[model samples]
Structures are given as structure tokens and as C-alpha cells.
Target chain A: MADTSSPPALHFTGHRHLVERLVLSTLTGRPIRVTKIRSSSVTDPGLAPYEVSFLRLLEAVTNGSQIEFSYTGTALAYRPGLITGSAAGHGASIDGVLRHEIPASCTRGVSYFLLPLCLLAPFSKSPVNVLFTGPGVITSATPTGDVSVDTVRTAILPIYEQFGIMNKLEIRTTQRSNPGPGGKGGTGEVQLIFGHQVRLPKTVHLLNPGRVKSIRGVAYATGVSGANNARMIEAARGVLNPFVPDTRIFSENTAAGFVPAPERNNAAAKRKMGVGFGLSLVAETSTGVRFSADVAVPVEGGVPPEDIGRKCAFQLLEAVEKGGCVDVVAAFTALTLMAMGSEDVGRIQIGRDVLGSEDIVQLARDFKTFGLSGWGLRDAGEGSEDIIVSIVGRGVGNVGRKVA
Target chain B: MPSLAPLGKRKRPTEAPKSAPATKPAPGTKAAEPESDGDSDLQAIFKRAFEAKFAPLPFAPAADEGNHESAEEEDEDEDEWTGFDSESESESESVPAPVVVVHSTPSRALEIDKSELKAFLSSKPPTAAKPTPFPSSGPKPTPAEDEDSAANLKNDVALQRLLSESHLLSADRTSGALDPTGKNRHKALDLRLQALGAKGSLFKQEKMPMAHRKGIVRKGAERETKRRKEAKEAGIVLEVAQKAKGKSVGRRERAVDAPAVGRFRGGTLVLNSRDVASIEGPKFKSKGKGKRRR
Candidate 1:
């Protein structure tokens, strides 16, 4: 929409961190170009189904976006437009909800889309209302390492509250499902309503990785015996009770979801999908810092419920032992909000391991390419291995917001 | 007290002669060996008895020993007393070992409140309005305050019930009791449910003959007018009656594909005079007092 000179598109390579880069482009109203997206793989190359579905979702939410792919589907270019959320007469339906259907070929969990959508919601012109449904909507953790929807609600969303974006936020799971056979797809439904928007996120200094005071969790069994939930809770509590006596893990059980799978002769045929059990645990510190762990049964399904529970408990302890204000699961969100804050610098003390990961390293490189300032890091204190990262905002806040 | 009294009395008679070896050591020298042991034993008995009735002695009997010899002598005397003292003292010491067994509670007690669990597990993220109230922080309400709250709640509920069900309570109807009987009770419950935000009364008949429904409406209106007339005669003010709603004169819902201004009859479009007049231009009136222009 700009007739004047706009900045040239930032160049990148490979498909890694595609969602994060696209989100940054949308927020800053910049154009991005990338080459060699899984180009090395001969059998299957270019963007995956879930990634293309995410791009479609972005087009639905924003006003005047453009996306193009090369002939081989490797190279790509995207020019982002104003984020007009779920405004009526757009792709939104009568109820003001944008219905997005995931194809049955998708393997990644629904959280793969949800986490990035939340980062963009607070800067949109209006509220973001999306209803995710279809056979590919896996509500449980997938073997591909995507977390479950429950963890997103229990763990990641609370971090936004620290940034002063904490009103009218909700995630409603109408149907719960685990990954289907071979980790392919599941029939599930989820709705996300994010009504809070701001001119700019508030600056924050989360320096203290406080002591863990309580643990809360959810154990769910879909289309399986609810005794699986009991077994999982028993095993998880057996481990966590010694450390924090104030632990509570609630149990949820539901019937398996059904999707139409019509054969040649039978047109009304339907089959059950997403039948499994899983557990998600969240540990909240005294200062409201949250560390989360999630584990689900694989589609081949030989592992016992007790094993899943014990594995999740140990996972939570490992996250807590990393010793940071934000764990690896939530570090991206915290760091992004800090970099997108008002002009002042926001500081956060993160675990050395979490900061040294590939995702954060790539983000640092992408920031430099986007003409944003580099991060300033120093040791946290006397005995901590944590590095306190200080990020200065670009002072280019929400372009969609009209009010002060 | 009586049991210990008899035991002490029995021990005193045997101990009086045992002290004869310490002061007159010549004649009782042969007996002095056991008698010296018995004399120290008697000192221990008196120490225990004095400490039991009053405060303990500041100094121990072993403190009087000047060097290692007297300490050895005290140890030798104690070795002989365990074999020589009565059996009841040893029995009381052995009885306390079994009582020290440690008993632990269950590691996790799933004592969750139903409402709290439902709220936490609901679709929305649990609002951090209140953190999980640990069972350890359970506040103990005082009995006096509990009683006061209970009485106040009971009075409030009674007052609300009376206000909502006042019409059901009449002198001829069960002599002005708080609760009505049979059909009136059901009606009272329906009224309460409607007040609680139910869309309509549960007893409202959805299907009925048109004539019967109209008759009931007329009878209700007649009854209301009679009550208003009586109230007016007695010089008592009454609420104004609400006027009945008029029939709607708005546009009817039509199908999306239907023609706007014509009816399709037998594959032919027919428009009325008003529709045709609207399609044509409005005719301008000629001014009588001015020149008429083309």
C-alpha cells in the first residue's frame, strides 16, 4: 500500500524458523525473501503442509498480503500487510470466527500454529478469533516434538500477562485428540479468542528465577480407559510430591473423535481417530515464572501410562534445573516481546543452555539482518551460570494501532 | 502412690542394718562388702525419692569422687547393682521401645474441591485472580462468626422467598402460609426459576387451541381490571396496566432469489400499479399562477 520507497526485502536461506521470521515481517510491515527451503531433500522438498496452512492463516487475518513460490517450490517471497484480525466481510464468517481447516496429511500438532498466532494477536487491529478443526488438528503432543494445546494454555499464555497483555484471552478445546496412527493426523477442534491489543507492549525486567512453590497438571485419556489417567497421575505425583508437596494433577477423559472415511460402497462411513492418553505438567514459581513439560503416547502405542508420567516428571525437573526466569519452551516468546517493547531496554536472565540453542542463535542473526540492534549480554551474578540478556526495542511499535 | 509406698516401706527395713558397716566397720567388716554396696544403693534411692518430690540435686553422687579410684569404685558398684536390683525397674525401661515406631501419612491426598477443579480444567486459561489455595492455608472460621453468618443467610433467603411468592400467599389460600400447596407450589417454583434467568416459566404451555388461549387471556384481563377497580374505590394507589403490543407492520422475509416488485404467475411477470408508478418518473404539478415551462 505504500507508494513511496519501501525498504528492500531481507534475504534468508533454508526453511528453519520460518514461522518466527514471517511473524516478525508482519509485525514490522517488512518484506522477506528466502531461498533453499528443504531443497536438499530429493523425495520431499519445500514447505510442509502445516507451514503452507500457516501462510494461508496469515493471509486470512491480514488485509493486503502477497505470497509467491518458485516453480520448484523452494524459493519464496512474502510481503506482509496490515494485520486486520477477524474483522467482518473478510475471511471471517457470520460469527466473526475465521474457520481454518487442517488437512489430514499434516503431522505437526495444533500448537505449531497456535504459538505463533498468539505472538501476532496482541498487535492486530481487532481481536483474533480462530476455530481450528479437521482431521489434522492434533490436540495432543506429536512425535515430531510439537507440544500439546494444553501446555500452550497452561504454560505459554501466562507469560503474556507479564507484558501487560492479559485481558479477554481464552483457549477452548471442544474436542481432545492424540496423534493418529503413524503420527499422521487426528480429528480435533479448538478455538482461540484473543481480544487484547495494545499500542506497545510494556517493558519488563524478569531477573529473578524464583523458587518453585507449586505444581499443577492435567492428565487426559481420549478413547482409552480412564484408568490410564489414574495411572499417569499416580506416577507423576509419586515423583513430584517429594519436591513440592503442593502438587495437583487433574484427570480428564473423553471419547475418541470420529471423522468421515467413506469407502467406495459405503458413503456414510466414519472411523474413530485420535485415540490415546497423555499428560502435561506446569510448574509455577513463587514469582509467577512457569516451566512446563509434556509427553504423549506414540501412535504405535506400546509404552505404558506410568512411563509417560515418570518421563514428564523428570522433564519438568530438568527444565527447572536449567535455572532461568524462562525455560526453553517459553524463551522465544519472552525474548520476542522484549525486543518488540517500547524504546527502553528490557532485560531477562535466561539459562545458558537455553540461550545457546539454535533457535535463539538464528533469531539473533535474523535481528541483525532486519536492521534491529544486537543484544547485550552479561553474567547474571555471583553463582549463577545464567546470562542476563538486555534487548533494546526498535521503537517501531504497532503500525496498526491508531490511538496512543 | 499406694503401690510405690509399699515397695519403699519394704526396702527401708532391709536397708537400716546395711548402713551399720559404714560407721561401725569393725564388727560388720565381713558383711561390710555387701553392706557398702547396699549403703551406696540406699543413697541412690533417697536421691531419686527427693528429686521426685522436689527439685533435683545440683550435684551428682559421682561428683564427690576425688580421683580415678573413686570413679572406678562407682562403676564397679553399678556393675553389681544391675544383677542385684529388683526386677520392676528394668521392666519399666523396656516398655517404651515399641511406642516409638514412626507412622507416616499418605504421600499425596487428592483432596480437591469440586468447583475449583472444574474451574481449573475448563477451556479458558485459569485466571490468576487467585492462586491455588493450598490445603495448608485453610482458614479456620470461628464458631461465633459462623453462627452469625448462618442466621443472616437464613433470614435473607426467607425474605427473598416471601417477596417473590407473596401473591401465592393469601388468607383464603392455606391461611397465609409462606408456602403454597400442590398446583400453587409448582407455580411458585416456576416463578423462582424465571427469576433465576430462565428464558421462560417451565409451566408455560407451548401448544394449545387458539380459542382456549384467547379465553384465558380475556379472563386474566378481566380479573386485573376488577382488582384495579376495587383498589380505586378504596382510595389505594395501583400500578398502571401495561398496554398490549400491536401487531407488526414490517416487511416480510423473502427468499434471496425472489423478484422484488413482481409476482411470477405461470411464467409471466405481473406488477401492480404502485410498483409501476414507482418505476416511472414522478409527474410534476403545473403552477396555476406562473408560466408553465416545458
Candidate 2:
């Protein structure tokens, strides 16, 4: 067992940073990027330009160091100048024109100028490339004068692709009304344009190496206690069954310890401390197997061996031992009968100071169905230590044959 | 022996046993003389009684005539009867005196004499006991005998007048000498007079003049009129004043601008235009035709 007596001081050195990065990467499945850094003081050597003050404070605390800090420095601000400004202006104008036009159309007739303004609002004040395919008379009126449609398309296509918004932009034109005091009439020609922009912020992504920290097993005589081993194995199986039913359990003996069933039972003379057994239960999904084992004697106080190795061996043996069976009837029947008649198995206590007589009687009757009988005992020691009986059973095999 | 001699001698001169002392009244010579005098006295008493029964008329007539003749004669006679002068027999001669007949029927005379004696006993000299003088009159009636006598006389006269007037009036009505309408008019007049008298007495006792009473009635009427005028004015003025005052007070209160103590007066806090513009970003501009700049 690992020493878990006192919490050790956490190291916030390079190793600690590596561990943190590893944990974060494993949890999020992505490289953690640091966008900016802020520091409280210029004199602190550990303070980096890109390190946040809170992270610095945490590192200081973990390193068991004192830091006298004052106000934090201002964070670096990113502004993309005319691109952001134009984009914001375009969005506002588009939203405003849409909001104004939709309601005005519903309330009155579609104004000729409003629709044209709504169409052109996204392109206004920004140098946006546009394509045109119209009557010769209409195409000749371009502001740049004499630009072909293919040239315009080529110019704007790369920009749209770079922003990853090529599918969102549409170039079209329609005739609609604009309503205001200066509106000329109900119809006018206007162009519609749409686009997006990409922003590369000041940030960096980093990755760290990873490795397994620990591996554990399900077994008795492994310092997990026989009962705890059984409970853990049961809980695991219980969880697996919802996703995969038709699971079964088996056991074998091995020098390593008790190996799961259908595996070659290997034993060495010097290492044979005692007879050993294992139980393996496979989920119906065949995706995994859960197993538990008990070794009568153990050479070391740890889990015997990995069930994965035994499972591989069991798969090979399963071919040769086709329909070869072990009789778990006696073991199962004994377990069932013991579960029925063994008083200790299901014995329940009507706890002292329980109020209703009827509840006590019902509890007693319920225990009786398990063939358990109980009498009140004073100073019975700790309730969980009181084991009144033990059960034993022979193994069983597939094809309903005994193998003991 | 001595006894025989005395018996013969005494028989001669013992005055015949004193002759039984004229037991029959000397039998003749007018044993009836005293009886006659008694009869004369009885006659005289009868005559005096008859004269007394008739004397008051002549006495009063003579007094009236004597008054016509002279106060001196009457005074003289009064003085004689009054016994003021013991020596004045001439005064009695000048007047016809009361007759006094003397006769011998002593019983009847005795009765008269008894009456005379009673009179004489009763009649002391007026000088000896003078009558009380009349009480002097003052603002208030005197409680003396004269006042009593006068009151009695007045009461008698009033009773007589009341009886006589009531009888005359009733008789006049019954006789039909006056017409029925006249009688009724008189009756009404009388009743009115009675009512007026009653009213007059009531007014006098209360010490109020008619004009003063009239003044009081007029003053009460004026007071009622003034009260109605004041009430009407007050009703109109109160409503208008209250309304005007209320409006003025309301205007003043609104104009003062100082927050009232209990009313919710602090205006709500609203974000200024710059703050809102900064927070929400710039407002979207419209692309309508721009206003012509001046």
C-alpha cells in the first residue's frame, strides 16, 4: 500500500507544470493555449509576460514561496483596426436595415429605397469585391469601370476562403422600396453583398509528454480483503450488465495466483503457497471481462496478475475445450441453498430503538424467507465483524458439466 | 186659777187674732187702681212699640228737612241726642220729641222699663266714648275701620252695578228692541273690549309698551332675514373659495419643487447617453437621404 499518511507539499516546478499540462490535455483532449500574461510586479523573475497573475499566485503557493504582490499590470489589448471597424459597422447597418425594412413592409408597402439600402449596407465603407452578371447596360455602370465578372470573383474568392465563410457570402441584387421623406419612388435597383472576416489572436498552443500513473486489479489476498474483492467484482459486473448482459463467471489455479477460468492452470513448486482460484465474468457485449480471485496463500501482498493475460490464454483454451464443462451446479446450488438456509447470509437486525412493533415483525418475517434466524445480542462487537457462518462450493463448466 | 182669768181677758183684745191681716185688699176703692196703672203702662208700651216700628222713615225725613232748614238745627238736635249738653231741653222742644206714655200696667211697663233700662245701660254719653276718627288716607289704603267700611261699601256698589248692568243688557236683548245683528255686533264689541282689556292688563303688568313689543317683533324679522342672507352668501363663498384656494395651493405646491416629505419624489436613476452608447456599442446608422445642411 502506498503511504497516504500526510499530504506532501506540491511542487510547482517544471515537473509540476508538466503534470498539470498532461492532466489538462488528457481531460480536454486538446493542447491548452495561453493567450496572454499579466504580472503584478516587474522585479519578479518567475513572472512571465504571458503568465496570468492568478496562475503565478498558484505556482507561488504550490512552491511554498511567499510573494508580496500589488496591482496587476494591464492586459494586452488586440484591435484589428479597419477590418474590425468596418465589420462592426457593416453588421450594425445590416441589422438596422433589416429591422427597419421588415416592419415597414408589413405596416406599409415595400419602400423602393429601403430594400436597396438594406442590400448595400453590408458592403458600404469597405472595399469588398463584387461579381456581376447583368444586362450590358447594367454591367457598364460599375464604379471601378470596365471590370469583368471573373476578375471580381477571383479577387474576393480567396478572402472568403481564408475566413472559412465562403459558403455564407452571396452576391445578388434586387429592386425594392425605401421609405423616407426623400424616397424617390417604390422601385430602385440595388446590390446585395455578404461576407465574413478571420481574426488571428495573440495566443500559443503547447503539448507535453504523457504516461500511465498506476494500474490496479480485482483480487482477494491482495490487501483488498476477501469481502471487498468480491464486492468490487460484483459492482463492476453490475455496471457492465446494463450495457452487456449474458455475462458468466469462472475460476482456475495458477502459480502467479488464481487465474480466470479456461486459462491453462500453471503452477510452480516453489511458488505454490496454496491452492488458488479465480472467477471471470464476460459481458454480453464481449467488449470486456471482469474477474475476481482468491489465493489461499500469497507470496506477496498485492494483486496476483493481470486478467488480460489470463483472458488471452482462456480464448486459446476455449477452442480445445469445446463443450468441456465444470460442474458449478453444486457450487451454485450450495450458494443458493446457503443463501436460503445459512442464517448468517441474510441475517438482519431489527436495530435497537426502532419504533414500530409491526415494522420489526415484518423485518423478521422477511429474514425468515432467507432461512435466517436471529436473536438479540448485547455487545455483539462491531456489527460488520460478526460473521456467523461460511460457505464453500465446487466449480462448474459450460455445457452443464462439473469440473471440480 | 190664773189661766181661767187670762183666757177671758185676752179674748177681748188679741186683735181678733190679728184679723188675718186684710187678706182681700181692703175689698173696694180700687183695689184695681194699681191694675189700671199697669194697664196704662201696657198701653203706653204698645204705643211706643208701634211708633218705633214706624220711626226710621220720619226720623230720616225729618233729618233731611232739618238739613234743608239749617245745619245749626240739625247740629243742635244731634247734640241733644248725643247727650253733649245736659242742660239743653230747649233743643229737644224745638224738635218733635219722642213720646213717652206712663200708665199703671206694670208688667207691660216693666218690659218697656227693662228695655229702657237696657238702653240706658247701653247708652253711655258719647263724650265718654268717642267713635274712632276716620283713618288718614295715603298711597296705600289704611287697614283701619274706615277703610274697611269704605271697601265694604265699594264692594256692595260694584256688586250692585254688575247685577244691574248685566240685567239691563240681558233685558235689552230679550226685548228685541235692538236688532239681532246689532246685538251680535254689541256682543262681539264687548268680547273685543274684554280681550283688549285682558291684553292691556297683561302688557301693563309686564311693564312693556306696545311700540317696544312691535320693535322686538320687527327686530326678530330682520334678524331672520339677515341670517338667511348671510347663510346664502356663506354657502356660495365657501364653495368658490375652497375651489379657488385648492387650485392655488395645488399650483403653489407643484411650483415649489421641493420634495414632499412622504411622497415618492426621488426621480429614478437612468443611464446617461454616453454610458449607454459605450456599453451597448454605437447605434446603427440609417442610410436614408441625409437632411439638407443649412
Could you say which candidate leads in lDDT? 1
Tens digits of per-residue lDDT, candidate 1, B164-283, equal 788777633655567677888888889888888889988789899999999999999999999999999999999877888888879888888778888778888899998898888687
> lDDT tens string, model 2, B1-294?
001111112112222434422222211111112334555446445545665786311111112222233344434454234442432333223432233322111111111234332322221110111232446676764579778899899998666545534644565555553322455445544544665574443223465889998988799779866776897988743233222233334434354654333233457445567655767786555565556422
TM-score (all chains, Cα) for each model: 0.64, 0.11
Cα shift from native, residue A101, model 2 (Å): 16
Off by over 4 Å in 1: A2-4, B1-106, B129-294
> If you assessed candidate 1 against the hidden native complex, which CAPRI class would it receive?
acceptable
Candidate 2's C-alpha runs over 4 A off are: A1-151, A162-165, A175-192, A201-404, B1-294
Docking class of 2: incorrect
Question: With candidate 2 superimposed using the best TM-score fit, by how many Å does residue A148's alpha carbon deviate from the native?
Answer: 4.8
Candidate 2 per-residue C-alpha lDDT over A1-404 given as tens digits, one digit per residue, 9 for 90 to 100:
01234223222222112222322221112222222223333564332321232233122111121223224322221111111112223432433221111211111122111112212222223323222111111111111121211112222222223212333343332321112111111121223243332221111110110111111121222212344334333433343333333222211111222211232554432221112222222111111111111112111223333332233224222311221111111111112222222123222211232212343344333333322333333322353222122322111101101110
Alpha-carbon deviation at A80 in model 1, angstroms: 0.6
